[model samples]
Target: MGAPQHEDVDTVDVDLYDPGDGSIPVFRWRQAGQALATRRQLREMGLRPGGQSPVARIECRGGRRFAWLYRIDLAKPKLPMTLAKELALDKAMAARQTCPKCGRRYHHVLPLKTLGSCLECHDGTPADPASYVTSAPAHRLAA
Candidate 1:
């Protein structure tokens, strides 16, 4: 129902866990040269964490996971997309639209598991059609 209140969780650990709303919610920003940013924050500035571990974290509401904080000073600029990488991404997206059983490409991704193929190839019979079509019992006349 709530974040676990352990003695160790009281102090925020930049390298381990974030102090949630349960007690301390935010960390102090110190010095003019220091900078901290989340993943999306780095992306907005056209930079990435570049395989560096987070220097800090901010706790989320549900306590599922902490939002990692990266030092903006150490972040690297995002790489430009290459022609080969562009082509590979296009091919992978196309594969998702193609149905393996029917060997056909669909504008929408096919429901492969349930229908096992395209809707046209699927047999549409009900699992128990007879049960659905039973007639009502005839009423008997009383004396």
Candidate 2:
């Protein structure tokens, strides 16, 4: 086996970390393969070039939406996985709330500090976030 080869550095500014970097440099780059897709395409497939937001943005062109900008941080494995999990957890939080002691459930905006243990669990108990486990699966499915 030999060392892997990498393409020459492609220094396009990432969307989340960068605002617009002027269209000229981006336009002149001569897209090697098929050009990266528009945000619409990515949204349809649920893949963001930069990943998801709090770090991704919807960019517009000519008054119509163009593409998604992602943070380079999204490319980091740890952050991407964490974001995916958070998104899933947010969806779950939106879905329902639970009583940790009785396992009965309810619906409400869960307190951020009480993410793991529900209101019932922490009733007169210490709010030790470290001791709790999220109800979310260990690995969340990408939306």
Candidate 3:
């Protein structure tokens, strides 16, 4: 069987958004390069646009999908990860691992909606001291 022919939906005119007039030009897919870089591309190079606006954009899939492009010359180096930020992230994760009912930290994530507590706390059989006292012998209770 022969491959089906697809209609071209991405036919935006590059002249409409002229790059010469300092305006952001919108090029077709795989066409925005040489002078521009996407966000992921910049990240791969350990660079960022800093605060500069996009120099252009790549539009595709009938203009439904678009990726903003920034000038490589204008991009800045990415900042280093700090110890303070790492510690804060660790604290946030620790809080999520702690069970509310048992006041204990669990290795695995607990189901908040279904269990709502630790496995021991949510079980059908009671495991508390009060339950043991109630189920004591009748003669012991009378004494």
Candidate 4:
């Protein structure tokens, strides 16, 4: 008998960083395989995890940074934006872009949290006329 010969085992030159404690497998950087995708990647593909748990993880920089990997086939299509959602989002943005003192809604976000009002109202800086709407409709979203 020569040195004990192991037979009937499949071997491949791939690094599977499994913790061996029954946890999900880990892969390095771009080694997570084509079937798996991170959350952001799924979103970019117009998909969502759809309540499915991650089956693996991909790490980089010596495991200091990692992202969960989900099966792309198990992902669901991203939800479509509805009229209600658009209205609610617009309302929220109005609160941030509208000046509290003059009620003018600027196209850009205002520093309300810091200065408590627009620059013109806070420090007498003359804002550009093209920067804001003089009078927004009272019920823009009304039918």
Candidate 5:
């Protein structure tokens, strides 16, 4: 027998989306003057820098355009958005809360309303407890 002939194979266009008259492409790219930084975010996320990267097709309500981030795999485990969100919330609640100044992380044992700042920031100075708990600006923190 010749190499067992399998007649049928699937080939199709997988470009799941249209970038909306190139506006989305321009919006997606963030570069400085003379800086090769269009969509530079892909680099840290272990993706190619050039515009050849493939974005995933995720189901969403309201049809609002948004980006979904994930590591590439031949197949990824699927879950409904509600369950996925619950799992993420549980995991985040379980994380060790960190101190910005001292870089110490401790179990988030206190009640959410009661716990204001990390132990170090709480004891060290009268800075806004909210400040230590803040996230970085969108432009500064990529991927």
Candidate 6:
């Protein structure tokens, strides 16, 4: 039998569908061929889509969850983390984890939005010493 024609439905069998109108094919979980991989899968393989558009989609749980599939052959190697990127990310995280009132940087993120400070600074809850750095980092990122 011939492949099924493209339709507007959500789920379609990859093997039985032919995308002649530039529409992306859809496949059930585990049915997408080895040549195709989702973003997370590509990341696990140390690859990125490299600006290529998705060639297909995979759906599971009756189409409630889906991921875009990219051509593995066209994927590029994942970029390595640089020292500057690491420092920048740490600086961003510092803003969230630091307490403005007490100058204490907690190991976990503080309730900055609602309380505007860490638990101890917010209501004198006596935060554990182990939970936060003794003091904020000495150096600050340049504005």
Which 10-residue window in model 1 sums to the lowest lDDT?
Answer: 131-140
Backbone clashes counted, model 3: 0
Tell me the tens digit of each residue's lDDT in model 2 across 27-74: 212131233444445445555555444333343342133333444434
- lDDT (Cα, tens digit) per residue for candidate 6, span 1-143: 87886654554333435554546777788899799999999999999999999998888876656889999999999877686789999999989999888778889999899999999878899999999987546753333
Q: What is the TM-score of each candidate against the true structure?
A: 0.35, 0.23, 0.43, 0.47, 0.21, 0.45
Per-residue lDDT of candidate 5, residues 68-124 (tens digit): 322243222333568889989765764445433344334444323454555445565
Per-residue lDDT, model 5, residue 143, is: 29
lDDT tens digits by residue: candidate 1, 68-88: 678898999888658678988
Output the better candidate (3/5) by lDDT: 3
- Model 5 TM-score is 0.21
Per-residue lDDT over 1-143 for candidate 3, one digit per residue giving the tens place of the 0 to 100 score: 77664532344443434554555677787787577889889999989988899877777765666788989889998876586688888777545654566555555565655778656678844444332223332233222
The lDDT per prediction is 0.58, 0.44, 0.66, 0.82, 0.39, 0.83
Which regions in candidate 3 have their CA more than 4 angstroms from the true location? 1-22, 82-143
Candidate ranking (TM-score, best to worst): 4, 6, 3, 1, 2, 5
Ranking by lDDT: 6, 4, 3, 1, 2, 5
lDDT of 5 at 86: 94
Q: Which candidate, 1 or 2, has the higher TM-score?
A: 1
The clash count of every prediction, one per candidate, is: 0, 1, 0, 0, 0, 0
Give the best candidate by TM-score.
4
- Give the clashing pairs for model 2: 50-70
**Candidate 6, TM-score vs. the true structure?**
0.45
lDDT string for model 4 (88-108, tens) is 999999999988887788999
> What shift in Å separates residue 75 of candidate 2 from its native position after superposition?
7.7
